[model samples]
Target: MMARTKGTANKASSQNENVVTLENPIKRGDTLIETITLIKPNAGTLRGVSLQDVATSDVNALIKVLPRMTYPSLTEHEVVNLELPDMIALAGQVIGFLSPTSVC
Candidate 1:
């Protein structure tokens, strides 16, 4: 887990904050579809996974990171079973939702 930073938001900064809204909001009583896809890595390959590889990689780091955002709602088991393309799509949605200003 990453350490949380402490800071106070100024009135102006807080007031002018940009919020990203989801098109399909996750509401109460909604049942999300569960699906899984599997991929096998080739032997003796030096290539590492990339965004394009999201369609084929056996393990996606992005999928693991999503649980940190969804928490109890999205368990490790659910994340591990997620399809590569689906994981990539979710990651894009998360990034779009957060609209981070900078990265550490």
Candidate 2:
């Protein structure tokens, strides 16, 4: 059996997440958040959002889903303020998460 290190569990779980570096950082209270990790959202996060919409890069779908998926979670308002490039990047990541190839 392979030996498990202290962060083995965290490392395993991190495989299901992707870190996105923002070209335009978000200011939350006193902090500027330059990167956000997008977790491979469970079914609960997809509720009330359409898979087709997410695949199509629908703005409403992004607003509805991002806060549920992002680490340092974005509010709907923050999602709205994302730059066009950032939004495109986010949409692409979300689409990738839906792909069967994303599973180990």
Candidate 3:
């Protein structure tokens, strides 16, 4: 077994696959959000949301689950206000989180 090197940890943290840079930034109060970072969800984060729907990139399911997984904590209004391209990108990230990675 090998110990994780500092360089390896730095590289892993440098590329955050879940951060969505908005094509059109959304405003919350006076704050203008440029990027949204979504954390990998746990079972609790999926509460009241269907995994199948999320895996399928269902908009309604994503809308329900995103706020739980997102940083800077979005409101329902904010989530609903996401531009089409931004929403699509976010949906893709969500799907990636649910997908299995290669066991290299």
Give the best candidate by TM-score: 3
TM-score of 1: 0.33
Query: What TM-scores do the predictions have?
Result: 0.33, 0.80, 0.82
Tens digits of lDDT, candidate 3, 8-96:
11212357756777778776655677677878999998998888999998888988988898776777778888888888888888888
Models sorted by lDDT, best on top: 2, 3, 1
Assess the local accuracy of residue 27 in candidate 2 as a C-alpha lDDT between 0 and 100.
Answer: 80
Cα error, candidate 1, residue 100 (Å): 4.9
Q: Summarize candidate 2's per-residue lDDT along 13-64 as a digit string, tens digits.
A: 4553366667787887767777777788898999998889988989999999
Q: Mind sharing the TM-score for model 3? A: 0.82
lDDT of 1 by residue, 2-92 (tens): 3322123221134322121222323223443332111122321213434344334335644544444442245557666655555555555
lDDT for each candidate structure: 0.39, 0.78, 0.76
**Of the candidates numbered 2 and 3, which has the greater lDDT value?**
2
Worst 10-residue lDDT window for candidate 1 reads 37-46
Pairs in clash, predicted candidate 3 = none
